[model samples]
Target: MAGHGDSFVDCGCSVVGQAGGEAAATAQRRVLARTASVCPVCLGPAPAERVAVGDAVLLVKRCPEHGEFSAPVWRGEPAFTGWVRPKIPTARRGPGTERALGCPNDCGLCPDHGQHTCTLLIEVTQRCNLRCPVCFASAGQGGGRAKGLEGLGGELGGRPGDERHEGDTRASRREDDPTLGELVARLAVLRPRAGDANIQLSGGEPTLRDDLPQLITAVRGLGYPFVQLNTNGLRLAREKGYAARLAAAGLDSVFLQFDGPDDAATARLRGLPLHADKVRAVEACAAAGLGVVLVCTVARGVNDHCLGDIVRFGLARVPVVRGAHFQPVSFFGRYEGFGAPSGASESAPGVATAGTDDRADDRKLDDLREAARITLPEVMRAVRDQTGGLIPLAHLHPPGCEHAQCSFSGTFMAHEDGRLEPAGGACCGTGGSGGAARDAGTGGMAPEPIPAALGAERARSFVRRQWRAPDPATVSADTDGARGGTLATPPRDDFERFLARAGRRFSVSGMAFQDAWTLDTERLRGCCIHVAAPDGRMVPFCAWNLTSVDGRPLHRNGAPSRTGVAGCGGLGSGEGAGA
Candidate 1:
């Protein structure tokens, strides 16, 4: 829609003649890019347009049968246009499998993909100890099915290879859990195929597996350079020796879910009041010499207000707290709005109710409503406001690995006294349309711009260093033959020298993933974070979790419908689901 007399268009007619023609000079929301999107109603491809809607941006699309739809893709100052840091698109490395269907459906990293894999997530199990109401994977203790590496391979198409089990045991395996041997076989295939991929061991809760240490050891044996565990931190808090055990097993880092600073916020997002447990978990990892990154799920009017506090807390922990990743809540499995009526309780602001038809398709353009949560830009502003302008919005690096609008990050040097000094300076792009704060002097200090050629490598290096947890027991020994020949450790004196050259650095990052409503195929093409599927396919993260408006999954697990999508079925244990 153009600003030419459309009902949705407003040229700021009231102030057009003011501000020495500044208002008159400004253009109304206009189309920026044409791309492919999915119809939230039918889950089919739709013609979409990325429009500069004032200071924010929105993705609008129309389905032949489902009418027009729109969703906010960017918000706040540093206009959407400014955040883009374009790079040369890489040529696809041949489709690993036949193109079964276009895009999303044929997610075998089909030769059409525009980005290379950076992080490969392997879901070890579908079972989770805590069932949060806003689960993207809808994981639980009793409902979902589970699969091992071999079974996962079958889902993709066929097993990687017909290799027999080597040194396997029944005690280490559960009904739905994968045997250590099966997992090793699966990774063995992925190791060389993905090429120097960073692996994250994920599950309902990776801590649930008793053989988790052995699993980590196997992945390390696969020669994966970096290995991380995604967990809720319950076990780490309760079991004083758990962190040390993981460190011994060669696990490099922990992606701990820390929603907010208060118990009320935690109860609202997670199922229980877990502030104390979260704190204890971080302390445990610190004592065990494990690095921790706090992963926060920001819900509007829920824990969104706690953004700055979370950053401060993360920085206060310094070398131990490596980073804070904020993810705005996206509607998918188990979402009923932040304060909507359900079993979970907290003194929320209010309840959000749809029309009489609770399951009405919200994808229609006429029915579009504002999401009830903070966005990436809002979080960036919060960081500036709460931190006394020490870290302004520009401090965040523009998108590099993912789509320009998908996320933002900033790296900083941390001191023991809790002072955070910007390490790489302001490393973000400015929306072509000038922003309110573009000339605000960025807290009176000029930012050092990161060169385009060095941006990606610099960002990757920082993430690698910040997220790695040094294990004293192993140092840098080659535990298995898979470790690329040999692993080397720096001497204590050498380590001190490295620390002096580059003090402890931490990243403050935010990723706003797309849900079915906002699944943009153009953005999908540039996704670098992928999940390893059983059939030897590498699926993009958002596409893997995408569910129809009615709750039928397009990839991985079959989910029950909230609006009655056909073929939807109950998820059972071992389904290999993830959040």
Candidate 2:
């Protein structure tokens, strides 16, 4: 593996010490694009550039006081320049806040932000039942003040008097879970601002709250069409009727934390052997007619080898398991013992230990870090390799809704005999008369380029239809609507035949989140996932979870105080709610 700034010649020789000093090494690098990022040490805005070195693309930035920092953003196959889906930047309908500070710092969905809310995450609580070592929110713990905002006070984007004093009541208030009335008020404020965005009730573990059924009912009552739960699945597995109760309460989908097929992977990542419990949870969801999407946190050298197995497991479950979603591990929140350097005892359990070498320098340490970090292209190739071409590289397409670099998705129709056929319109080619090209999956003409706004709207509809449990009434109407159970008019065409088995559709997608080391303000501005803040504002997902190297948050615990805006008050002081 190559380090962050390492460069080499075609003949594979190191060119760092050949006598031209620093300028010689700098000449070998090719600058790709200029953007803005924040320093991992200080959380201050800095100018950054994407540069290609060897086969990797690194995001390199320098803070005047903190010096230079570099991290690999893309590496190997599918080529960075070729994996682009250009979008006509569409701003939000009504700006939530003024542009006071800058891009990420002024994130009240300021007028300059370039995307609408595809999914609005409302964290119902900051408490959890399990203490997983890889939590992004650092949940199930108490930390009143935002460490990243310490001392800077109002200068860091809050109002003049918004700074917290030593004995302020807000600090203690941070520990209390929001009451039901408070959540209803928050939903009323969000219903107008978010306008038709999908709702996800996230938490330390949302199941920990006894009123979760009530919360789901409340969300649906406010006219949000879809409601999903992000959970670990312990309660759903152990409590017999829990899944049915949630389904009856108007819940549509379950984003279950299912790491892999067996205990070997779960014990290493989740601190216990939970494969059996996860299976039972899925079965329970199936029994209750609730659709489930298996969510896996892909960590390099740990569960990276388990992607194919996870996909196979989901496929075996068919309509009950709607999809498999993989997320590359980002260095933030609670990933303490996982990414340590070579020879450290704090390495995650069951991982192979590296031999001790006192001669390891900063560059060698950086190589280890880069090796631990996995890129989106690498994951795509891994899926191709691990699944033996069941999912080919050509079938996977750049996301139509988000920045092309953020994700890749493919839809497949599963057969009863365990074969997957790529559905048409999976790829979003460039849009216009000239944009039509050959469809890689079917050798036919492909769909034209999709505008960003239209792409987002279609994506929301697709998720609602595919990820929700099949409606019994609609299924009966399609399969047995005729008298005496005969087809009304036989099958007209192959397209109608395909629609007959629509319940078998399955999706495979991966999302690469940005951490302090990988944050690119360009990608941040195009983000479609937004978090609804207690202060009656919407913040982009990445900006809300941005934290320094030492776990100090930028916006999670430090949102501005709530104003007297109608239906926006009384949201409790709990911090960092969503996954």
Candidate 3:
């Protein structure tokens, strides 16, 4: 078994017993645990097992109709079993819907859920400005809704009562952009249910809306404390004072879609060269006193190798560039040629890359899919390896709000000398009882259960305090001097210097969203980030985005109804929000 500090490698671990002629490989494997999953082909519930082989863990499941599926969930260092953060399951209070179905099928935040909402995403529109090859929401112009009858119930599968009448015309079923009045009504209904959970305004591209500032104002007016916009910075870079207008509207931060450090990385992932626009957007946000978090969609052989460069770039911007968040690509919405076995090219122009050409063979394609995945452990190791251990594996801890395996995050203090030192606090730990010695394979000791509600609250508070830009009034003059600006008077003492440096906190984190291929019911049940559906139910983020291999959605464009709330008629008539 390898340790966290070991040199990063593919390890080439495969699913041994998943297919015939691999009987010899099964002898070296071990079953670690059992859980529930959904078939990637049929979207039906399937019993699954976590199998450990070499230093990796693969999620293996067999659908009665769709056969077997396996994908790597963890790889390389920090050991899968040891990375545990146990939370006492929070009882679902005031559930939005009754459990007519089970687990994911009954995902209106049914009583079976194990965690509370930390961030509630509201997709404002489905119309996007750019066409990225790897979009989870599959956003587009003219709306991404299907044509004619295909756009209704059968293709866009949903729970009961989500079906539209056959006589409904294409004009009637059109996924229109929600009006300001409709959004306000929906928010009013969700306010009592969501409490103070952070609000993220997302869409095809949120900046596309001219009345975006008004929407932000409405969110703030409704008493939500923090509101962040999810966008690609094209508009902010092209239009002067755009960021300032958003700031004036009471927006706290910008979740900028920043793929990598250079244009080549952007071109490969996002269809065109966008590095310059991303930089200008950051500058605009900085000028407007708005905090920005650089979000990178990490795809294998694309931007995964540049994680270190992205972090270094964010650090150079300091308080304005508050954090860097990485998301490993999941095959759900518009990934045309993501995991295709060799020779298949991505649908986006010039965005194509190498993949296995085994599409004709189902077993071979499954093997390729397993090979293409870049798991959470792999991402943690990449950060450490690419940054030359500046962000050590020990410093990165499992999440407190979401499932332990879903993400990892750490905060570092950036000093004038360009060193990133770990700002260890309650969030940093092996999450175990006492100071027990870590096991050889698992990175830490068995975790002791903490209150799930406490974890959710703590995560919400941390993001609110750390993700926002440091107040200009409290920033010491020495801080400006550190960034090459002149200081009227240098820090008088070491304490002042320490205070100045402490104010420059930079966060590094990565989240692995489960796709149909990797949908773990246990993880889904414990999800903290949720989406606010038009029908007034808070659906977990993954559940809202989950799609089968054929591209039929489980919840996206779900039929909207007005039964739950008062005064909000014609709700769910339009498309929901996304990022």
Candidate 4:
């Protein structure tokens, strides 16, 4: 009744839809104009054709000024518990550096993961209130103790990672247990980059610490850029203003663990119906003005059906909700009964590199692919359809990812309302590069600037406020100068690349859905760094993982054990390394 313009706008305005002008059809698509769809960035009624025909995923939008831009498909409003709301009026960048991961072969920057090891996260405790089975930290395996596993260190068996403290068990283990003030003092010695360096306080449950807020205050006093907590929402929801208290104490944001709407799935993952609790926690975080990046450990056949539901949940939270991040169950650390029979996992479709590899008991990146059983792009497509095209791959997609598409986990799609787009969607990590955007990162979108569409005010506002780094570049190199240390490059491939290759080796994919997908050659050469000093900084141009990154088997994804390898032989932070 209104006009074709109304129809285009109703479709949520493709990036090229707003500007109704001549040549507005975009040579990119107007060049193939048999029929025009809708575009927002370039204005209405633009020659915007769908990329993946039957996919129903509005992949790209053609804009005359912007050429073509990524677009997400939106579904509808989300369905989360009524109480939740956003805390921060606007989303702030979460923890971690803009350019954290590095480029393999020394592409450009100053190697050592671009930003260098400015901030290194240390998990003091692997204990938690809930036994989330999906937790790679293996909180479920513990007996609800305050620290890590009881006597048995590492996984359920084998030698503990950091056993230096193990001997301290006799006569009041105080020296081995570094207090917050003590930890901060040790951190001070690290001499993190002046203003750029940061410190993330992660654990089985950092909030579980009786003196968390106080310790956070101390960490803040250390002049850290921001302090973040990785937690499962128990104390956050129950303790009113808990998040705000930490925020005021210099806590930046929270990496909250959240799945989707499936109460059953939540129960399975958390060993309890945490759906309502998680919602309450989000609301509490919002009320506290704390930014949140919903973290989900995506597992095929587990809660995959709830992908759309997850995005919807995040979006409804509005401003406080920055975005959702997905971490396809990395088969590292302590996750026990979570993967497939083969014990491998993959990222979502189009996102996964290859399939998981056999012969790997724990943390074989290759084996993770087999476990994930999906590609990165395919997951991106699902996210787009679920979110109703509001969140595009480029907007929330990964940057320089192996594939053009990023796994839904590391990305957060933005929408006009200022709240996150596809709020309730799920997330996880993995790779894919069958040729999509081709420039997004492992946890970010392509380096390209976001289009000035949506609203001139809103668009400009976002570019100025939300964008974290101008160019999120990755720095990597061999730095072998022919140095020594079990550091052997992967034969034809170096360690980082080889590991990345292993990361994607096994997995499932395609509508045909085989057990494998494509792998990003660059990611395979896993970035390697040698901890040269006790400051927690990684030596530049170091070789990738030659023998083992952390420990092998039981202690592979080692957390700092007071008496583990981290603390053994005075090897800088040795005890802290083997959690």
Candidate 5:
């Protein structure tokens, strides 16, 4: 970030471009030749199409049927905030595209996850009670070298026989190890100070874990403060007081997988009919006074017809069902060989893409901006209508962006109406696209213009920040002894100091979390910074060695990050059924 001075490149269409990807000259050619003119949702010409505005090509798309969205570009700017914010490139993994390859697939952000990220995506378990086709967790499988609690625990650099964390060049983790303390200690290290640390409790149905309550208690015991659970609803719907029991276990909310109503949606998405049960689960949670965040994976072909309906469902349950996150199908685990039909006369840019439904490969970052037909302000206006109320888009200014132009990052909003106003929705890699602002003191900042170069990369870094794939080099021998990655540890005194700055004090109510939201992530990421433990295991809440982008210091999880963490469930509470 220091020696490099090549900030903005000339989209060359006019002024120089920012430090993102290609400039206007290249972007225009890509969209005109490879992109389409219709809205990916309704298959109609995007509303307010903003094409070629100086070095940028803005696209403002709104649909009465689908959600509202906007993409703007100004390739002619200098580097993103002159090193104040820089993109952290994701390491290419064993098998995956070079990223930046999905945007062309649709009008959404880069399928490479153009935006949004949760530094820590705590999936309590890869096991689920119900087996659904589109289940993102890809859970509900049997044993036999399964990566269960230990797999999860090792994420924090502590999993049992956890010797690899020692940092010994020769030290490494074994194949199987399950220790809870190492995980707890690690979480204590990663727990964000100001913002709630996100912990998504997933499962072969966490309720199935007889030790579910104890696990929840363990996470609560740790100072997580915020917790969320992802479930199929079998336990909560059928079992009476199931939700109550979980609430009593110190659960904050549930990111229930409610695709649609009736068995139709359930069958289509889950490959089984359980709509009734799904509704029951939602109701049960509401009855138990637990916040509910509906999780829907918007498949282009599978449940294409239900997009609008899902929004309405969330709107109807507003306030109680805080919000809903829509993830366009990701081609992973179970979705590996999946394919979506592109035969529709007027389909999205890359409708026919296989196993890439989630990545916007149909539309590249350049294409999305070129196809920009909607604006944040405009999208908000439409959202207000869909929600049957005024969901002023202004309410959703990309809260924690890494760029000056709010749009350069992704889009996100702090909306009360159950749907994300986040930079981009989870669907089509939405959350981290727009780089809007929020008050610095109160988590609000004024909207700024976007620079081209920083747009895609900034968004990528955001997603990487949220990606769950830990470094294999860091795990092993912590809680669940298993071969894994290497991680750093946090200082104890600094951890305490960070917590104090976050205004987080335990309430006698026995609740560890209360009103956590994405305010200033820079000030909250302290929780994620950590030091390598004596044994080389990654520590969770250790709190030392954590510093801000500028060494200013930040709390963990910021407000917006908190929502994803809490909604996914079981984050703050790391223990799953096995725990």
Candidate 6:
């Protein structure tokens, strides 16, 4: 009865819904509509339809060469059809490519592509220290296969791609990694076009690069409003000064890979008992004035149960731990299995792409169903159940910049006793000089979906004001030495004091990336997260990770060209790219 027209709720204004009872009944019976898709097996174009299966929506399509396929794209109470946010169409221009290869291949934000760039993900390397059972990037030792080594698969035990020869280590892969100058130039390209786009430094552990601080400083100098570091936090825990160096270099946020709260969860996902180390990493970041967003790769039977606990943990940390982001596993890259076996030992076969029983381990993307994966509605339901219903359904808002069904966000105010209240409407606390319309509280109403132009500024402000944690001096003394970091600092400055007052409010948000099986061109048209490619073009993040049936990645264009930097020499970022 309290329903209102807002981003979170669809007004009963649809032509069919508002039509006569007879018309409405007929509309309800209409279960199929056309869309577009890609065959997971061949990565070929396929005509698709949205078929209503009970309350869930299934994308059913057929490829000339790959046969028929269907995957669950949406589900839950209201039905997927009614969950769409009003479309906000931006100006469309011709794509950078000549339109030779079509929808995905014309990926230089091709003319047919629907959206402008929102968040630019700049991958710095293909090397990683740890090898996980499920890795989308296939990031491990030896720069993840040579330039064009495709179709190398067998089973667990051998190298990542199951290549006969041992791949290059992190040290051996440095020459191909993007340099600071090249990254700066890439950002320069986005400045005039995308305009103040948020840049996230990602790849086989961005922190592994010793010159990260230098890179962060370089990124900031180029006038990018927000610079985020995506890392596993292993380096942050071991190197006490690492977080501080990043902060001093103008790093705005750390997207830390936090699978769950226990050592077992860490070992299952990351192949090590990293719970203690994750905590230390959070503490180090908090002490050094860096905001952290816990990024949990949510596997259904894996660490999905810990979603609520992860949110509570983040709320307890307040301004420092800004949010917890949950990503339902999208079967892409080198992912081997759906869920880890119970009591998975350290020596247990990982979910690597190189599994011998390829059919048993690798999910044929074409055969994927709604039951095979977790959906956003399911995740929200789990979070609500975990928190005892304190997290209101209305608090989840349709994304302002991305596809409505792609993601949802909720903002909350943290209490000293660990209770979290939705920060909107009647409960929204008094605020400062910031815009009240954009305030956390709007009477529990969802904020209107914003266009790309406005979304960028709003994103920058949110990261600066809400993501940055409160001054350490104002935190409860009981949390001291909890993470064992040496970057603690004395509180100083009026700005810090002012931010402390506004820091209690933080946000929880996530985006479900579409893999090849769920590749809908409609969703692609609305994508805002773009991966910066070496060809000086921006490819949608999902498209970049989408792989062909033969295991060839769509947009992984290799390392960008270096500018005036010295040749890649010396022992770079000491993490061995060994499995």
Q: Which candidate is the best by TM-score?
A: 3
lDDT (0 to 1) per candidate? 0.61, 0.67, 0.70, 0.38, 0.35, 0.60
Instruction: Give candidate 5 regions above 4 Å deviation.
Output: 1-27, 30-119, 142-185, 192-196, 340-396, 401-579
CA deviation > 4 Å runs, candidate 3: 1-12, 15-24, 142-175, 339-371, 426-447, 478-499, 559-579
lDDT of 3 by residue, 396-498 (tens): 7787778888888888888768898877642422233211124333444565677888888888888887787766643457555223122356567887666
Q: Name the better of 2 and 3 by lDDT.
A: 3
| Residue-by-residue lDDT tens digits, candidate 1, 1-579 | 111121131212222455645444345647898887765544556678877745666777765554566567766666665565565556445446444345565566776676666678887876565656567665543221222112211211112441111211111124677667878888787765566667888865678778899998888888887788888898899886999999899888899999988788777666668799899888888777778999998876787777888888877665667788889887655454432222132211111123423222222211222446456787777777877776766567556556667787777776545677777543222222122234344433222443332433444445566687533332333222221111265435766545532425777888888876577887887787788876677888898777655444666542222332213332111111111
| lDDT per residue as tens, model 6, 222-241 | 88778898887877888768
lDDT of 5 by residue, 193-214 (tens): 2123345554435565556677
**Which wins on lDDT, candidate 5 or candidate 6?**
6
- Clash count, candidate 1: 20
Score every model by TM-score. Answer: 0.75, 0.79, 0.82, 0.49, 0.43, 0.76
- Model 6 earns a TM-score of 0.76
Per-model RMSD to reference: 10.9, 9.9, 9.3, 21.5, 19.3, 11.6
TM-score of 4: 0.49
> Which residue pairs of candidate 3 clash?
82-442, 123-577, 123-578, 124-577, 341-355, 341-356, 341-357, 342-355, 342-356, 342-357
Candidate 5 Cα lDDT to native: 0.35
Cα misplacement distance, residue 159 of candidate 2 (Å): 37
State the number of backbone clashes in model 4: 137
Q: State in Å the error of residue 415, model 4.
A: 6.0
Evaluate model 5: give its TM-score: 0.43
lDDT value for candidate 1?
0.61
Arranged by lDDT with the best first, the candidates are 3, 2, 1, 6, 4, 5
